[model samples]
Target: MGWCSCINLFPPSCQLSELKSTMYERQKKLFDSCQRASKVVAYRLKTPPYKLDALEPYMSQRTLELHWGGHHRQYLEYLNRALGKNDILYGCTIDELVKVTYNNGSPLPEFNNAAQ
Candidate 1:
C-alpha cells in the first residue's frame, strides 16, 4: 500500500469499506502502470548525449575520448549499479529513470550517484 491509501484508511476515522477498496484499487493501478512502463523501455542500447566529432579539434579523437571512453563506459557502470538491488526500481528501465529524474528532487540514491 502507498501513503495515499494509508491516509484514506484510518484517517479521521472509517467510512464505508468502499473507500478502502477504492484506495486499494488506485494503488494497485499505480503499481501495475509502473510495472508496465518498466518493461516497455528495458534492455535498450546506450547512446551518447552528443554526436561524434561534434566537439571538433579541441576535443579531437573526441568521439572516442568522450563517446566511447567516457559516456559509453559510464552507461555500463551505471547499469551495473542501478541493477544491484531488487529494490523498488530493480525492474525499472534506464529510459524510465532518465525520464523520471530529469528534474531536481531527492536524488535516486543509487542511480543519481551512478549516472554522475
Candidate 2:
C-alpha cells in the first residue's frame, strides 16, 4: 500500500497513523532515490542548432553537410559502440565516462577519441 492510499483509512486527528504516514513518506523517498540511481542514461548527439543555409557567405552548404551530417554523426556512432563493450562505462554521464577512462593523464586507446 502506498503512503497516499493509507491516508483514506485514517481520521484527521489520528496522531499515531499520521506518524506512520510521515515515516512512510521518508522511506518512500529513500527507496525512490535508490531505484533512480540504478537506471541507465543513454547518450545522444544534439542536432545542429541552425539550418545549413544559416552560415552562408563565409561557409558553403556542402561544408555544413559534411561537418554536421557526416563527421559529427560518425563520432556519435563510435561513442555508442565504445559504450557497448564496457559494462562499467555503460550509461555513465559523458563527463563521468571521460574522467573514468582518462587513465590519470593518458586515455585507454580504443575509447580515447570517443571520450574526448
Candidate 3:
C-alpha cells in the first residue's frame, strides 16, 4: 500500500492526534498574523453574512462599525478564548490536521474551537 494508505488504517484517537498537529501548524500562521496586527485579533464570520457593501445603502459606514467592529470582532475575541492555550494550535498546520481527521469524518473538537 501507498504511504498515505496507512492514514486510513489508524485508530480514531491517532487520527485525531494527527489532525490536531496539522491544524495546529496551519493555525499558527493565522495566529502569527494576528500577533503582527495592532489589535492582535483575527476574524471569523458566520454565513448569511456578506461584506459591508453587500448590504449596500442600508449598511452605512456607521452600520459597518457596529456590525464588523462590534459584532464580528467580539466573536473572534470570544473564539480565541474558547481555544484555551496559545501553544497548542500554534505548532501544527491545518492541512496535516485535515488529513489525519479525514479518517474520523470530522475534525477533533479543538479544531472546531480553534478554526472558529
Candidate 4:
C-alpha cells in the first residue's frame, strides 16, 4: 500500500488532498513575497551645493568634477546595482547596510559599495 493509504485517522484520498492543498498554500505565499520584493528602488546622485568650480583657489574645477561626478557617481551606481529590489539589503539605510555588510571584522562583498 502507498504511504497515504496507511493513514487511519482520515481517508487516504482526504489525506492526499490535504497535503496538496498545504503545499499549494506555501507556494502561493512564496510567490507573493517575491512579487512584493521585485520593486527595486533607484537612488539618485545629489549634486554639490555649490558649482563645480566653487573652490577654485583650493581645488580646480576639473579635479572636483572628476572626483564628484566620476568616482563618487560610479560608487553610487555600484551600490545601487549591488542592492537590487530582490536583495534583503535593498531597503536598509546606508548606516544599517554598512554595519550588516561589515559582518563584525570580516566584510561582505557589498561592504565597499555600501560604505562608499
Per-residue accuracy of model 1 over 22-46 as CA lDDT, tens digit each: 6556534543466453253223445
- Residue 53, model 4: lDDT of 89
Looking at model 2, residue 21 earns an lDDT score of 72
**Residue-wise lDDT of candidate 2 within 28-110, one digit each (tens)?**
44334442344455556677788887889888889988887788777777777776775555655565556545656656543
Cα lDDT tens digits, model 4, 1-116, are 55555547866677777886765565345434542433436656788899998898899999998998898888888888877733566655566567766766778667897787
Candidate 3 per-residue lDDT over residues 7-79, each given as its tens digit: 4666667777788787667655555544221332333554546665677686686787687678766655664
- Total colliding residue pairs, candidate 3: 9
Regions more than 4 Å wrong, model 1:
1-31, 35-55, 62-64, 99-104, 113-116
**How high is each candidate's TM-score?**
0.42, 0.57, 0.33, 0.60
Evaluate residue 31 in candidate 1 and report its C-alpha lDDT on the 0 to 100 scale. 39
lDDT of 1 at 96: 50
Candidate 1 C-alpha error for residue 50, in Å: 9.7
Supply candidate 1's per-residue lDDT for 108.
Answer: 42
* lDDT of all predictions: 0.53, 0.62, 0.52, 0.69
Clashing residue pairs found in predicted model 4: none
Q: How accurate is candidate 1 locally (lDDT)?
A: 0.53
Between candidates 1 and 4, the one scoring higher on TM-score is 4
Question: Model 2, clash count?
Answer: 0
lDDT for position 3 in model 3? 58
The candidate that wins on lDDT is 4
Give the lowest summed-lDDT range of ten residues in model 1: 36-45
Ranking by lDDT: 4, 2, 1, 3
